[model samples]
Target: GSFAVSSFVSTIGKSAFSLPFEDGSGAALAADAGSLAGYVYLNAGGTLVRQPGPVVGAELSWNGLRLTVTASLPAEAGISGYTGKPTCVSLSGPVAAGGSEYDVTSVMDGAFRSCKTLASASLPGVEEIGKESFYGCSKLVSVSIPDAKSVGVKAFARCSHLSELDMGGHLRTVSAYAFFGCSALASFDGGGSLKTVGSYAFSGCSSLRDVSLGPALATIGAKAFASCPIESVDLSPVLKTVKDQAFAGLEFRDSGGSVLAHTAAALRGHAFSGSGGVLVAEQ
Candidate 1:
């Protein structure tokens, strides 16, 4: 069986193919998407192509083109054999095998963890990212994952050099410690679609200064945005809940430009911890 992705094709639609891999042990192909995980392909032009080769002995290399993942990734999907030679990685569309297409939906735990040499990523069609998937990738700098829905715990933690994030619509939850310790992260553009932010999601992002949360945000969990240097954020009015220390160590301001205790009606216990600063509600 072979899979091929055509070149010049910019966007691969969701659920366009079906191809999943099991653990890193062997090239164990599956009969369906749920049985395996982590299938990737290199697009050639108008086709998605893959050569049926042994995972252990495969000469895995990304010459210049980006490695596009086309299935839900399993643990160690790109970790065991990858040397991080590619400058960019993305999750898009599906891969074809035996004339059938499988959808590339989510990233599994530790799928790309510790790929210190990897630099950039683009995940336009991904629905979720698993825990510690990109953790400790010191060289990772930018990302554009537009259609993400949920980000698992510690997914991008300790990516010290990461700077840019362009989140897109349809996003929902950000799990605990999703971006913890990303010291170089400067801004987050949660573009028009987000719901809940989990505990300690953005803790220790020292360089982050600006954030644009979408209108659909509802909950901010414990220490969700702690230890950042953000000066202000325009919060959505319909926000319902905020747990303890959600905004600890952040600087906030009101519309009147006066620094005061946040009076948002949805704030729960100790919503803003260190400096009594609260996000200014955006009208």
Candidate 2:
């Protein structure tokens, strides 16, 4: 069924109503607290195509009183298919520390693409972080997605300037280039269900220090942690596979107890092409 958002675009609250999209008329629909969003996807020519579910946290409240997400998303809770301007998104006002959630109707995937100056965001209990979720966010200094689970490929690729990431214990997986060029990230606290780390997950993270792999993760795909400033490879017992070039340009040694040079000799591809560091065997 098609979704509809009413004409009340001043306040961001919870309520549900169906608006008419035919003919030529706009009406205000009042919603309640349990429900918190209203949107109908539009095509390139600005025609309604899909009905977006309840929009939570920040809703694009501009554009002649209408916004559209017509990117053909993956149709999952935390996944994304968002596009266009970064108008006004809602904040949870004031809750407790680690208490408030922005998962009301998570559509963060490609939601804020190339919105480099997005200095504010609030999403929690999100499941899958779609590719390039925050690509090219050059001015993002802080972010708070404490309950995210699976992060899709290039989720934060080329976010050249970001700091203070707070991924809580509930996070699970991370796709390629999850933080490719986020040069300002300092530390990360792995979540619970994260099992896979894809290629370039943290490549070129110039300011990153260290990331403790999740206890349940079993695989580290190629170039998963390629270029960073980390000091060591702190592996978890659940790790099983470290793909070729997974940590190419870093000081990370595999579970094989061999130095990176020696390990790369046995792998399927180069593991230290442009990286700078020493690889000592785990004694």
Candidate 3:
């Protein structure tokens, strides 16, 4: 069986790991670097790589300062497979490079996929969250993203426990399948800044009860809210276009509200198939 060796010796600027000598000629190293607890080691061909990761039972990861000068996170910002399941995760705040601090502006694709025990997250400075960022985080209950402008495809899919999401004021677009299978998501107010809700964006969110369509909304793509259990919807008067089956299988009734009237007039054919409902004014 093979074994690992580590040392406490620190490099000039970045963290480095002492590799197991293949030729077996150097002095042996010991496990003295106890402070770098969550660092993961990977054997790359013959070189050993070290990266920051989640702790044994930590409630958060990426909670400290890091260097950020590249287009994407350095393969270490995302974490998974912790022995002690974490209930909370916060991937936000600042990064440093050349002694200057920069706000973490984006979450990379598939950042926290399959983290089943994660229950909450708060991304403060993030402007864009990539595809499948929190996919399969089944226990996720809440999310708060203060600066997000766009949510990527399937970003929060399969989050069965996700009940609340505060998509702060600056959001512009909700991509396809963004909240697919999020059964517990019950509310969303895309604020006046929202423009587009892509295809299947909120499809299969069966527990969703209501939606407040923002004043600036223009497009609702195909099956945008299909299969939701919403009872009421305040469709924006400014809403112009709705694609195929955008609101299919919903439980909303034509409450005779002017908002519903305007929405009915704009809906494409068969938009509400299962509800035996159409946007008709109340008699």
- Tell me each candidate's RMSD, in Å, in order: 10.4, 11.8, 12.6
How do all the candidates rank in terms of lDDT, highest first? 3, 1, 2
User: Against the true structure, what is each candidate's TM-score?
Assistant: 0.64, 0.59, 0.63
Candidate 3 stretches with Cα past 4 Å from truth are 1-61, 64-68, 71-85, 96-100, 251-283
Candidate 1 structure quality by residue, lDDT tens digits, 1-283: 4343332234554554554433334444343433322344434443333443223212223323222333232211222224436667765555343233434455657867888678988866567777888888889999777778888889999999999886677778888999999999988866667878899998999887776676777788888888887754656666877778777865554445556543346332212222233455343
lDDT of 2 by residue, 1-283 (tens): 4444342433644332243232123232234422223445443243334343333333333221122222122211232433354433433422111222222334356756787446756566454466777777777777777767777777778877678787777777888788888888866667666677887788778776656665677777787666666654455565667787776665534446454442323332222222246543344
lDDT for predicted candidate 2 compared with the true structure: 0.55
Selected candidate, larger lDDT, 2 vs 3: 3
Top model number, lDDT: 3
lDDT of 3 at 66: 27
Q: Give each model's whole-structure lDDT.
A: 0.63, 0.55, 0.64
Say which prediction, candidate 1 or candidate 3, comes out ahead on TM-score: 1
Off by over 4 Å in 1: 1-85, 97-99, 251-259, 266-283
> Higher-TM-score candidate among 2 and 3?
3
Worst 10 residues of 3 by lDDT: 67-76
